[model samples]
Structures are given as C-alpha cells and as structure tokens.
Target: MSLIYPPLQAPKRLLFGPGPSMVAPRVYQAMTQNVVGHLDPFFFQVADEIRSLLGYAYSTSNQFNLAISGTGSSGMEAAVANFTEPGMKFALLTNGFFGDRLGEMARRQGGEVVRLAKPWGEPYDPQEGREFILRERPQVVAFVQAETSTGMFNQAKPICEAAHEVDALTIADCVTSLGGMPVLVDENGIDIAYSCTQKGLGCPPGLAPMTVSPRALDRLKARKTPVQSWYLDLQLLDTFYTGHKYHHTASATLFYALREGLAMVAEEGRENRWQRHQRNHQAFVAGIEAMGLGMHVQNPAGRLWTLNTPRVPEGVDDAKVRAWLLEKRGIEIAGGFGPLAGKVFRIGLMGHGSTEDNVALILEALADALKA
Candidate 1:
C-alpha cells in the first residue's frame, strides 16, 4: 500500500522558550517571497544588508562578519577551530552547559583546555578569572557572555580586559545575548564573538551570526596549520563572503528572511529594542513574584533580560506544567537542562516576541499551571 505525505500547517504558539523565539511577522512573510539564485546580484545585496545589520546588532565595527548556514554551535566550532591550533593552551570559564560545550570543542580541536569553573547562576569574577589566566597562561580565553542554561550574564568588559592584559584572545558566546543587549564587541575588546539568529534576532534557527576582530583575523591569517573542520574554515569562508566566488551552496531563502529580519530590527532601533526587552523582563519578574514564584538568578542586574529562569515551585512537576502550557494553552516555555534540570523553567522574552502582553499571558498560564 502506498502512503501519501501531507501538506504542512504549524499550530499557532506563543514561544517563551530558550531558543527559537517567535519569528517577527515581517521575517515570516519574507521567507515566503520569491526565491533567487545565491549568486544573483540581488542576493549579494541581501548578503551585504545582513552583514551590516549583524554588525549593528552586535555593536561591532569588525570588518569580518558573516552568518554561517548553521546553528549557534556551528559558529562556536568555527571560531575555536579556525583560530586555535594543536598544543595551544586555552582557558574556558565554565558556569553552565554552553561554556562546557565550548571547552569540549576546543579540546577536540587539540587545544589544551583548562577550566575556571564557577557555580551555576553566578558570573565569573574578573579578578578570579585573571588569577586563573595568569596561572594557566593560555593562548586563548573563552566564556559565554550570556549563559542561557543558568540565566546568568557574564559582563564582557572586565573579562576581556583581563584576557587581553595577558595577551590571550577573547572568545565570547553571545548566542542568547545578541540583539537583546549591548554586546559592544569592539569597545569591550572581544577578539571573537558568535550568536544565533533564532534567539534575539527574531528569525528562524539556521544561521549563526559571527564576527572576528582584526586581532582574531590576524591569528587565522598566521595559523601554521589548516583548520581541522574544512567546512568552517574562516579563511575560505571569507573568500566566499568577500570578492572571491562562492565556496558552498548558500541558502538564498534564509538569506532573504535574515535581510527582512534585520530590516525590522533597524526599524525598531537597537537601543529601543534592548529597553523593550528589559521592560518586559521586569514586568514578567514582577508578575511571577506576585504569584509567589521565585527567580533563580539572584542579581537582577546579572540576569539575562532575554531568557529568564524562574524557580519551579515545590510539588510542581516541570514536565507536567510545560505540557499543560503547550497542549492546553498553546504556550511554549522550556524546562531546565544540565545542572539546572528540573530546578527552573526558562522563559524567553526576546526580539519581536518580547512584549507586555506575551509576558502577562505566560505568567497567568504559569500561575494556573503551578496550581494544577
């Protein structure tokens, strides 16, 4: 017997999860536009627009900026693999899952990885980080600027200064921070940074927004060995993004979506967008606390405005509450992972999805779900 494949129709959902926050309507509409060849002049214009917007969103003046055709992990691996070589020492500040993953990726690339581990939900202190750096004297120091898993924000300035003082390259994971907060990569002295389009960019997940400072680019230029991951090698990828011809099959449709998304971001204005997210986050916290729920991250200033993790009330099964929210209310909130598993629920207020109404709706549903 032959079976027929069905057409697609996605259910309407209010996404308040760790990633894949709701795509702006404009971005969604752009995805449905006419598809063009990747090499077309118009497509190159789209690429140019995307690079400019990414630089603005990331608050960077770096000449090297591109969106890789993959998720945030792809960007992370690309940054580490291209710049770090075998037998080189690298220090990783691990307080959450993504930080550990970066460390693992660095090790896999044959870099000697040393950890300056901190408790989850706590940002690493710059002085302590410096002490570790001085002890390890690593060639590179990496940390997550926004620890999504634990709802902690690592202030990039001090950490970058400490790394730079010791002559180590600074790599930051802004996967959950970009477009939500001021990254100010050039001002903060970040050598390399990577973000995901799905989180704060109000776009779907396929693209990894990445940028490298002139210093990091210099390292790539001076590398004695080829990058282990040929597909992610920045030297060749630069050729495709620059004057040289295409090196791989680029996604024209997604590029269109990204261009439209960046346009919406420009319309909203970056500073205004950041303030909007902060406002919604404050309101969400107020509503949740008013309902007697506690926040996981102690310092309000250190909490990630885009991704909020609230402590799950006692006797409330996170799985059950999450299921009720999705199946019954059509609202999606994420459960904790790694060290935070079953302890807190991650609620994202990001990009176009960060709104007063959305926050209140999620809180109301959450209160009811908790009572049930």
Candidate 2:
C-alpha cells in the first residue's frame, strides 16, 4: 500500500473524558519554546522548581517528591516494585479497575496479593479492610483514592488508619485526585502516593508525580531483597529525586510544561481550584438530573469531584451518544470500564476544563445527542 499523509491540522477537541483535561494556554506555550539540553543549568533549575511544586501539589513536606518520566501507571509500578519483595504478602483494596491493576502489578513482582473488593460502582469500606488486614497482615496496603472507573472517591483517612493499625504501609493512587481535590498526604498518613500530569494538573500526560513518605523510604531501605525492576528501582530514582545525584536523563521540555502548569495551579490557588471543580460538579449534577439522567454512584458525597459517572438513560446506546456528541459538538466523554461499561458515561470537570461554560456546553451537547 502507498503511504498516506494525515490531515495537516487536527480536530479541536474539548476533552472532558477520564483524563487529559484541557491544557492551560501557558502550559501549551511552554512546550513550544526552544529546546534545551536535559542537563543544562537552566533546565536543572526548572526541574528543581517542578519538584517543589509537586511537593505542594501533593500537600506533603516529603523530600522524595519528583516526577517519573512516564504515565501514572508507571508511578504505580515504581511504588510497588520499590517497597515489595518476592513472596511477601501485599494487600489491596479493590473498588475499581485501577485498584485491581495495582494488585496485579504487585503480584507480577512476586508479591503474595490479597484483595479486599467491593462492587464495581461502590467504595471499599475501610472498617472492613481493617478487619481483613488484621487477619492477612500484609506488608503493604494499596488502593486508589479516586476510583476513576466508577466515579467513586475512596476516603483515604480511615483506610490509611486501618492499614497503619496492621503495621502495613499505604500506597495511594491519586491520579485523578491530586489537583481537583485535597490530597493532604502527610495529614492522611499515606506512605506513598502517585499522580499523573494529564488529569487534574491540566497538562499533557508525560510525568508521574509521586511522593514517598519517610516511613515508606525506610521500608525500601530495609527490604530483605533488592527490587526486581531496574528501570523503576527506587534506589536509583531516590538518588536523583532526593539527593540530586543525576541518575538518568529527563526531558527538559516536559519539565518546562509541567512547571508552567503548576504555576497556573498556584495562581488559581489550591483551595479555589478545588472549589471550582466542586462547584462545577454541583452545577453539572443539577443539569444532568434535570435531563432525567441518574448518577451511577448515588451517594453524592462519595462521587469524585473530577470525574462523574452518570447512568446511561434507558433506551440509549451509550457509545452512540458519545460519538454523536464528539462528532457534532467537539466534546469528548468516556464510557465505564470493566463491568460498568455501557452502563454509564464518565464526564470530567478538572483543572482548566472545570468551568461553567464547559459544563454547560457538555450538558447541551449531551442533551442533543440523547434526543437524536
């Protein structure tokens, strides 16, 4: 077959999907600047500034905060591979797909995985997990703070408390939670937490911002055997992220973009940014209910501020409606994952995408798509 060139310009999309919410203009501008060597003095300063912002974003004073040169899933792998050894018991609280994925990755690294599960659209109960952990007594308890699959926000305080009661380290997936809502990693007693740039941070995906608490760091240093994944090994990464030992080359351009994004976040102010998402969610929920659509997670308090999973109305093809909205209105949403697929539509109100105009536009487009 002859080679074919694609269109010169891509279609303009209003991203209101699972992640990769709309990017701020400054972040976009940052990426278009002239490139610099990864180890250039100015780029090194930029990287250090990004790390400081990551510390603030994660709401921790951790000295080990830094961005991995990969997606959020890579951050999960790094967390698991660093703290877990072969044949050691690791506990997971699985309420959605990502939580289960964490358990799977841990198992692949030779962890004896034990899962505590709830239904697909429900949140895992920390009290129940506490009882199970007391019995299983795993070395680590891992879970997703915001279960993106079902739009359920897993409350971390009680879960972290439960895990600590059993003397297990806590690893939280804050991929969808970091910027939209309050993470409070230090106050919540989370041993390790990982997030991505694309979701609430309002930047294109590239960096996995993570923080490992001092306790978790100590556990890694005390591990009986060396971690298996060399690329994701915490020992080498720690030297670079914590001690500035320069372990591997990092992308200076993406760090520039990330720095710009974090600056935007600071300008908005964390509390105000969080309030914007919550207010937008409330407005959207009201609009969706007015259109007779039910939410998948009935408890409003348990719903995620960043991602909303609304039940697909009866007699509607979920994917068909999504396609209609995208084709006709340039709006993009997501369908549910795993067992929740086709049952709900996932709408994101995050970062720069979380605005009254975007919310209204999406609701109007969804209404039109449903009627057609």
**Candidate topping TM-score:** 1
For each of the candidates, the C-alpha root-mean-square deviation to the true structure, in angstroms, is: 1.1, 1.6
TM-score computed on alpha carbons, candidate 1: 0.98
Q: lDDT tens string, model 1, 321-358? A: 99999999999999998778899999999988999999
Off by over 4 Å in 2: 1-8
Local error of candidate 2 at 79, Å?
Answer: 1.0
The TM-scores of all predictions, comma-separated, are 0.98, 0.96
**How well does model 2 score by local distance difference test?**
0.88
lDDT of 2 at 74: 92
In model 1, the Cα lDDT at residue 83 comes to 73
lDDT of 2 by residue, 1-372 (tens): 798988799789999999889998988999998888765778768878887888888889997887888888999999999988999899999889999899899989999999999988787666787788888988999989998899989888887888898889999999999899998899899999999999999999988888989889888889888789877777787676545567678887788888988888888888888899999999999999999889999899999999999999878899999899889888889998689888999999998899999889999989999999
